[model samples]
Structures are given as structure tokens and as C-alpha cells.
Target: MKTYDAIVIGAGPGGYPCAIRLAQLKQKVLCIEKENVGGVCLNWGCIPSKALISAAHLYEKSQAGAAMGIKVSGVELDANKMQDWKEGIVKKLTGGVGSLLKGNGADVVNGTATVVGPKRVDVTRADGSVEQFEATKAIVIATGSTTIEIPTFKFDGDTIIGAKEAVSLRRIPKRLMVIGGGVIGLELGMVYQAFGAELIVVEALPELLTGVDPDCTKIVERKILKRGGTIHKNAKALGYEKQKDGSVGVKILADGKEQTIVVDTVLVAVGMRPSSKGLGLEKVGVTVDQRGFVPTDKFCRTNVPSIYAIGDVSGPPLLAHKATKEGEIAAEVIAGHKAEKDWVAIPGAIFTDPEIATVGLTEAEAKAKGLEVSIGKFPFSVLGKAMAMNETEGFVKIVADKKTKQVLGVHIVGPEASTMISEASLSLEMAAFLEDLSLTIHPHPTLGESLMEAAAHAMGAAIHIANR
Candidate 1:
């Protein structure tokens, strides 16, 4: 009959934040985790992947440094050492998360908790003991998604692999076939590309980065192509079979015909579906849609009273930041505080070489909605910062409503575009118009100035480039 104010199931980027916030608000909170407290993001997804990518980036930079008047000798790739370094970062981060939760007065229960009722869960401990607890107030589910596997495929976590295995591989594959050219696919492909792998990306879509700006997509493709990598768009992966030599045999349909490609490794980056299974939602009368998303309000309350769900199990965008924000809103709502979440735009970014980041709507989306929009673009080739960095192969584009001058969208494909999109995200959130951005001052000889120039270009007042 033990009870708590709030019980957060899954101590991920979302759940832990909610649990900590609730505890800080003077609530008796219990955070349950089946595996490591930091969950997939800290354990597998973001931190580990980024750690490995950091090594790859530094190596590539050192290689490029030779051309830029910096000399180095005897560079080598140590897969085990790279993995150990990345795992060390994860260990430190997850340990920090555990300490924060405990220090915040949150009870960190190390076990899987299955919902048996609207406000109750059955916890299965590591030692195979079961304990039941009732949540006196709210129950938050933040279980994130897992990698999807194709039918008739064996996931050895080595040769035929997913992002998780691809990140922690001991040896680099000479050639890599990346299936499904989306965010995960492109990210890993670029990682391997930076590590000197011959990469081939296959996508079933007519265009790369569906729902992204076509102009941005074109720039990314051109950059990858210039690097001697191959991309086959509008291609379907039929199936994969083992080769005689134990490499991999991949059957694909591209250029309106069937073909086979042999490679040492295959990284399946199709996509991820929500992990809303085995929690007994139906038994408790909680409604989950066909897509497995637990629908919620702005405050993230579930259909059932005193029940809430956040993060990947909830819905789209599946971003850690989105989940963290949603966790705050849910926590505040349970605490009987006025909490509202309004986003004009949730910017999405692909962390590839010359990263791609976009906020608000794309040109095609605006055109589809039949809005008269003024479009403005500025190439990175004209920027002093890009030239100075010797990476001038992208642009910044702005789309605004022709009538109201409201900034509709901002898209960029260049170095650090992921970090640079934060300004546009805030501007869009404030519903700032093109005039607002045009009037804002931006310091010269920096990457941020491109945004200001693009905004001015949208209003036909740009000073740097010729009239558009």
C-alpha cells in the first residue's frame, strides 16, 4: 500500500527531468528505471553517438588541417579506444543524472514498472521480486522508442546493424550501404564518411529529407556527392541475405529495376516507432491510437485522470528537448500550477557535415498551403567566416508571408547550422515577422550575420548580396 505523489516510469531525458522537477516542487516522487537510470539517450542514442562522432570529426579536421598549413603525422583509428572514450562520457553523464535525482529528493527505483491501474504500477525488481505502488497524484510514462528491424533480417549487431551497433563497432567497414536516407541514416553515413568509408545511401522517397526544404536537400546531396559518395533516391530495399563470404548481400530496386549490392556492413536506418508496449494500457482503459502514441493535451495529461505520458511514446518530433519541455509542463500541471506550452515552430536539424537546420514551414509546405510567400536565399560562399573556415558550400534561406511580412520559415545548410538554428527557433516562437529580424542588428564577420542578411533579403533590403 506504499504510495507517492508522482511516479515517473522511465528515467530518460524526459522522465528524470520531470521527476527532479516534481521533487524540487516538494512532492514525494518515485522514478522507476528498468536498466540504467539515464535510459537510451544517455546510454545509447545521443551521448554515445555524439562521442564517437567527435573523434571522427577531430580526425577529419586534422586531415584537412594539413592543407590549411597545419602538419600532423602518424594518425590512426583505434575503435576500442574510441568506444571506451564514448562509454566513459556516458558513464559520467548517467552517474551525474543518478546523483541529481537522488540529491533532488527523488526516489530512484531501479526496476521496470508496469501499469496495472490508472494510478498504480507493478514494479519488477532486478532480483525477480514484484512490488506494487499506487501513485497518489499523477503517473508519467516516458518510455522512449527503439530501433526498428526489417523482416527476414538478422541483427548481429556487427555486420548487419542499427545505429546502436554502428556507433560502437570495433572495426570500420571499408564500404557501407546505408538504407533509408533519413536523419539517423544520414548522421551515421556522415560519421562513416568522416572516417573514410565509401558510403552508399538508398532512399525510397522521391526526395531526401522529406518535409524539409528542397533547396536545403539539394545542397546536402551536392556536398555528399562532391565527397565521392553515392546516393540513389526513390529506391526501395527489398531484402538482405548473407553472402557466401559472410559480408552481406542486399537486394534493392532503383532506376526502375532490381539490383544487388555487396558490402561489408549494412546500416538500417529506416525509422523508429513508439515503444508503448507491455504497459497494459488497455487494461486500465487508457486510449492509445493505432500509431501507438498516447495522445495528450498541452499539459500532457492522458485521457485517464491523474495519468500522463511524455516523450517518444507520446508522438512525433521525438526530440529530447521536446520531451524535456513536455516533462516540465506535465510536472507543473500535476503541481496545480498554471503551465502552458506554445511553440510557433519546433526546429528540426540533421547533424551532417555542413549541418542542416530549419524552423517553421518549408517553401513546398507554404506553397501547398497556398500562401503567398517571399523567399530569400544567401549563399555561404559570400560569407567571410565560411571562407575563413574553408567550408563555404551552403546557404541560408528565409520565407515570409508576402502580406503580413511574418517570418514563415528559416532554413540553412552550413557548418554549425544545428547550433545556429536556436535564434530562428526563438524568433518563430515570438511570432516575429521579417521586419523584426530585418531591424535587428547582427555583428559582422560571424556566421550569425548570415541570418540577419537572409532576413533583410526577404524584405528586399539586403546589403551584402546583389538584389534578388
Candidate 2:
């Protein structure tokens, strides 16, 4: 048996960073992973999906270069080559993670680890060998989550699949039906749509991208419609049938009616469930909620002092960046440093056609809290940069306190919205007021200037747009 100061189970965005940080803090750490080191985010979810989205975006853009006076011809998508390129990116990232762990002096073991006790873990290696390791100080559970499969639409890895399969499609489907309209579903669905697949999104919720700013979501919805994609909200995917022609017939309940839609593929992207079970956490007295989330305090500490949880296994807003931050906090706290999960907000970015990014509260959320608010919106259609790029499909919206003038939230749906949201996140973090943002000199004719203009519009002092 080997003993270490800390043991991190699952070498994902949450676990690897915790181990690396612990090692950096002069503590001995072991990071054990059942599969690859980089976990789903790096290996399958975030990296691969983004690569495909980028390629699709470029492919779609290449077709319109004639209008820009740049003659372009023979624009095409080579699926196998695209898949190979995406896999190469995944390899580079996962390899970099392994090297970083070794360079940082953190030990990594390839195996499935289960907590045998509060401070002990049993790891089953790939070769059917077992090893025991003890954590002298703490054991961090960063097991992450798995894709949720509907009972009736279980993944067959072919006809019906999850986000993992959707990102790896080698051929564009003639017709694609996505069961969920959340981030994973829409992002991947739109990728195929860009590649010439007819898309049908059936979301059980009342709206697509639920909890996102409805106004921002509206732009994406409009784009999907313009692309000849179908959307059904307030709908449920009851089940699916295997067609004789190697296709899928999905039955969806929407608008108080049942309809069967036939498609070449069905992407089940309802959501993810925490991989908290089967880890022997219950025997060690670790508390996992009914929804499979391991509850943690501000410091990422669980009920058991020596046991901690982070990432998707920990709680909501299961973003890769959120998991990475939590990992750092847990490591610092375990190393006797003062750190906690303290942040104004966790920003979200959806890589739809025009993209949607947001930070802090939405208008409805603020209204629900009974706060008097002022909203300002600036359309990208009127922006010099957006017009120049020929991508003027969305806008920037700023929500602020009516009296205090404190900026509450920033929602954007336009070109580079994902890249533009970091500034808004920083503004919220610094508690910047509407005046602070409005008066700040943003670079002229940039997408970022829209943010400054939106702030000024909230105060009825905008120059580029009519003040409300």
C-alpha cells in the first residue's frame, strides 16, 4: 500500500488540476483515472465539438467568399479527414495533460478507483491488477458525469446516440432529430445542420436553451428556422423505432399531440448525470444527494472532513471551466491555503450559428428577485465591425439596476460572443456600474465596443444606437 497527502479520483478537468495544484503546493498527490487522462471535456465533449464547429463554420463561410470578391470554388467537407483532424487535436490535448501531471510531480494511475474507506482507495487497473492507496489527508472525488440516456431511446452507438457520437459523425445525416435543445444538443445539431443535415430539435422544456436569456435564444431560434431546421418546444421524446431502411423513427409528444418523425439518426442529448454511484461513497459515509450530486461546502469540502467533491459530481452548472476552478479551490484548501468557491457568476457560451454568451442574471431572473432594472440592447446589424464581417445576426444586451446603476448581467448573441463575454464577466466580478462600462473607452469599430454602447444605452446616453 502507498500513502499520499491527497488522492484524486478521475483525471478530468476537476481531478487533474486538483492533483497538479496539490503537487505545486508541495503536497504529495495521486490522480487516478479509469479511462483517458483528460476526461470527457478534453477528449470528447469540449475540444472535439469545438473543432467540428470551427470546421463547419469555416466551411460555411468559404461558400460565400465570391461576394467578398475572393473567388472560391470546390468548397467541400471531407468527413473522414475532418474526424482525423479532430482526433489529432484530442490527442495533443490529452497528451499535454499527461505531461503536465508528470512535470508538476503528481502521480497518475490508469484505473478505476473506489473509496474503500474515508481515507483509503482501491484501484482496479486495466490489466486486472488491483492496488491499494491511502490518502493521509484528503480524497477528492472528481469522477465527473455521464450522458443521460432516455429509457426508451437508449444509445445504440449508431442509429441512436449521445453527444459523443454526434461529434464524431463521419457522414452527414439526411435528417437528424435531437431530443434536447440545450447547449449540447443545439451546438452539435447546428454543426450537422451546417454540414447540410436537416435538423429537428424536440425539447421537453417550454423553451430551447432554458435558463438562457430568452432574447438571446430567440436569435438562435430564428437562425435555425432560417436554415430550414424544425424546433418543437414543450415536447417530450417518448421513444423511437428502428426503421427497416436503416433509419430511425422518433415519436415525440408536443403541443398535446404525438408525432413520429423519421430520420437517419437520433441524437439523445437530454443532459448529463453525475457519476457518483458505484464509487463506494455510500459505504464511506459520504453524502450524495438524490440527484447523485455530492454536496460540498464553500471550500469544496464534503460532510466528511477528509473527503471532498468537485465538478459534475459536485453540483449544478456543470461546466468544464467551473470544474477546473473548483479543482483548484479544493487543492488549495487541502494544502492549508485559504481558498473557496467564490465567484460572482459562472458565464456560459453556446456556439450556435451567431453564438450566445451570458454572465450573471437574466432579465427574468432579476425581475423574479423583485429588483427594479433597466435593459439596454444594441444590435450587431448596426455595428461597423459586424457589418464588415458580414455576420450581423444578433445583439448585445445589458441589464442594470434602475437606481444604483450597477450592472447586473450582460447577454450577447452575435459574432464572437463567446470571446466577447470575458469582459462582461470581469465587469461583473469587479462590481462595475453601468457608468463605469459606458465611460470606458472600448477600441473603435470592434465587437467589444458593442458592450460599451449597450451600457450607455441602458443609461439613455448611447451614441451609436437610440437610447431607450
Candidate 3:
């Protein structure tokens, strides 16, 4: 048996970082992976999807370049080339992850791990060789989650598919139907929509992006409508039938009516369920919740002190960055350094058309908490940078406490909203007040200036837009 100070399973955004950090703390750490180094986030989910989205966005921009007085003809999309370029990026990134692990003095092993005891793991390698490793101190589980598949509309890997196949499609379908209106569905659906696919989105929920600020979602909804896409909310997809012409006829129930729509492809992006079973968790007496999530304390420790869990396997807000943060915290705790899962907020960035990013509380959430609040908004249409880029389609919204004037939340739906939300996240983490944001000098004519102005507007001191 190979013995180590700590053994981290599932070299994902969560597990790998934990191993690296443990090594940084001079702990003997071994990171095990069943698949590629970066897990789904790098190999199949975030990185690949963003590459496709970027290509789609650039292709869309090329078509609209006439507005900028640039007359370039023959705007075409080479799907094969785009896919190759995306693959190149994935290869480089996964390679970098492997190098980082080795450079940080963590041992990397390729195998599927099963917990046999509180701190003992049995790993089966590709060649059917089994090895047992003992973690003297801790064993971290970070298996992440798998996409949920609707029984009726099973992924055929061609016609009816999940987000995994959706991102790797070499040819854009002429007509695409997205089964969910959440982040993954909308983001990938709009990518193909930009590439000339007539989109039809059917969401079971009453609204698209149920948790996002409605005002921001409204702008994205309008853009989908303007692009000739159809949105069906409060709807359910019962099943899908294969058509004679190599397409699919989907059956949907919406507004108490049944309808069938034919489309070239159907994307099932309903949600993800944690990958918590088949790991002998029950044998080790680790408690998993009803939803299959492995419950962990602030230190990412399970009921068993020797065992810990993080990322999607541990709980909600299944984001890569959140997983990474938790990984570092867990590593620190295991390394005898004082650390816990303590953070003001975990920000979210949606790469939909025009983008949407948010940090901290929404207005409704603040109101629901019975806290008096004030709102400030600034439209990108009035911003010089947005006008120069000819992508003026959304706005920045700031929510603050009425009495304390402390910044509670910041929401943005505009160009580069993903990049802009970082500042908002730092503000919330630092517990900055409205006056702190407003008084801070921002670079002139930048998208960040909107955040500063929105804070000013919250205090009735806005210079650009009419203060409320």
C-alpha cells in the first residue's frame, strides 16, 4: 500500500487545487483522476463552451460590421476550423493543469478511486491494475456532478443531446430546440442561434433564468425574440420522436395544450445531479443528503473527520471558481493552517449574448429578507464605449441598503459583464458602502464607469443618467 499524508480524488477544479495547495503547505499529496486532468469544466463544460461562444460572437460581429463603416464581404463560418481551434485551446489548458500539479510537487495518478475505509482508497487503473493508497491525514472527495438526462428525451448523441455534445457540434443545426432556459441551455442555444439556427427554447419554469434579476433576463429575452427565436416558458417537454428525415419531433405541454415541434436538434440542459453514489460512501459512514449531495462542515469535513468533500459533490452553486476556493480552504485546513469556507459571496457570470454577471443579493432577495433597499441603474446604450463597440444592449444595476447605503448586490447585463463583475465581487467581499464605490475614481469612458455611476445614482449623485 502506498501511503501519503493526503489523497485527493477527481483531479477537477476542486480536487487538483486542493492537492496543489496541500503540496504548497509541504504535505505529501497525491491527486487521482479518472478522466482528463481538468475534468468536465475544462474538457467538456466551461472552457470548450466559451470557445464556441466566442467564435459565434465574433462571427455575429463580422456580419454587423457595416455599422462601423467597415465593408468586408464574404463573411463565412468554418465550423471545422473553429472546432480545431477550440480543441487546441483545450489541449493546451489540460496540459498546463498537468504541469502545474507536477510543478507543485503533487503526485498525479490516472485511475478510478473507490473509498474502502475512512482514509483508504482503492484505485483501478486503465490496465485493470488495482492499487491501494492510505491517506494518513485526510481523503478528499471532489467527484463533481453529471448532467441530468430526461428519460423521455434520451441523448442519442446526435439528434437529442446534452450540453456536452452541444458544444462540439461541427455543423450548426438549421433549427435547434433547447429544453432548458438556464445558463447552460441559453448560452449554448444562443451560440447556434448566432450561427443561423432558428432557436426554440422550452423551459418548465415560469421564467427563463429563474434566479437572475428579471430586468436583466428581459433584455436577453428581447434579443432572442429579435433574432427570430421562440421562447416557451411554463412549458414541459414530454418526449421526442424521431422524424423520417433524420430530425426529431418534440412533444411539449404548455398552457394546458400539447404541441409537437420539429427541429434538427434538441439540447437537454435541464440541470446537473451530484456524482455521489458508487464510491462506498455509505460503507465509510459518510452522510449524503436526499439530493445526493455529500454534506460538509465549514472546513469541508464530512461526519468522518478523515473524509472531506467539496465542489458539486458537496453542495449547490456548482461553479468552478467556487470549487477552487473550497479546495484551497480544505487544503489549508488539512495542512494545519487555519481556514474555512468563509466568503461574502460567490459571484456568477453568464455568457449569454451581451453577457450577464451578478454578485451578492438580488433586490427581491434583499426585500424578502425585510431589509429596506434602493436600486440604481445605468444603461449601456448611453455609454460611449458601448456605442463605439455598437453593442449597446443592456445595463448595470446596483442594489444597496437604504439606511446604511452599503452595497448589497450588483447586477450587470451588457458587454463584458463577466469581466466587470469581478470588481463588484471585490466590493461585496470588502463590504464596501455605496459611497466607497461612488467616491472611487474609475477610468473614463470604460464599462467599469457604469458601476461607479450606478453607485452614484443610488445616492442621488449620478452625473450621466437621470438620478432616481
- What is the alpha-carbon lDDT of model 3 when measured against the actual structure? 0.94
Instruction: Give TM-scores for every candidate, taking all chains together and pairing residue i with residue i.
Output: 0.97, 0.99, 0.99
lDDT digits (tens) for residues 1-468 of candidate 3: 999999999888999999999999999999999989998899999999999999998898888888788887898999999999999999999999999999999999999899999999999999999999999999999999989999898889999999889889999899999999999999999999999999999999999998999999999999999999999999999988888899899999999999999999999999999998989999989999999999999999999999999999999999999999999999999999999988999999999997999999999999999999989899999999889889899999999999999999999999999999999999999999999999999998798999999999999999999986
Q: How many backbone clashes does candidate 1 have?
A: 0
Rank ordering of all candidates by lDDT, starting from the highest:
3, 2, 1
Question: Which portions of model 2 miss their true places by more than 4 Å?
Answer: none
Please, what are the lDDT tens digits per residue for candidate 1 over residues 1-468?
Answer: 689999999999889999999998999999999889787789888788777767877888777886688988888988888888888999999999999999999998888789999899999998999999999998999997888888755578878888878878888888899988888888888888878888899999998778788888888788678878989999988887788888888889999999998888999888888888988887898889998889988889889988899988999897888888888888888988988667677888887776899999888888789999998788889999988988887999988899998888999999779888999888888889887887888887888888888888887888889866
RMSD of each: 1.4, 0.9, 0.8
Worst 10 residues of 3 by lDDT: 63-72
Ranking under TM-score, best-scoring first? 3, 2, 1
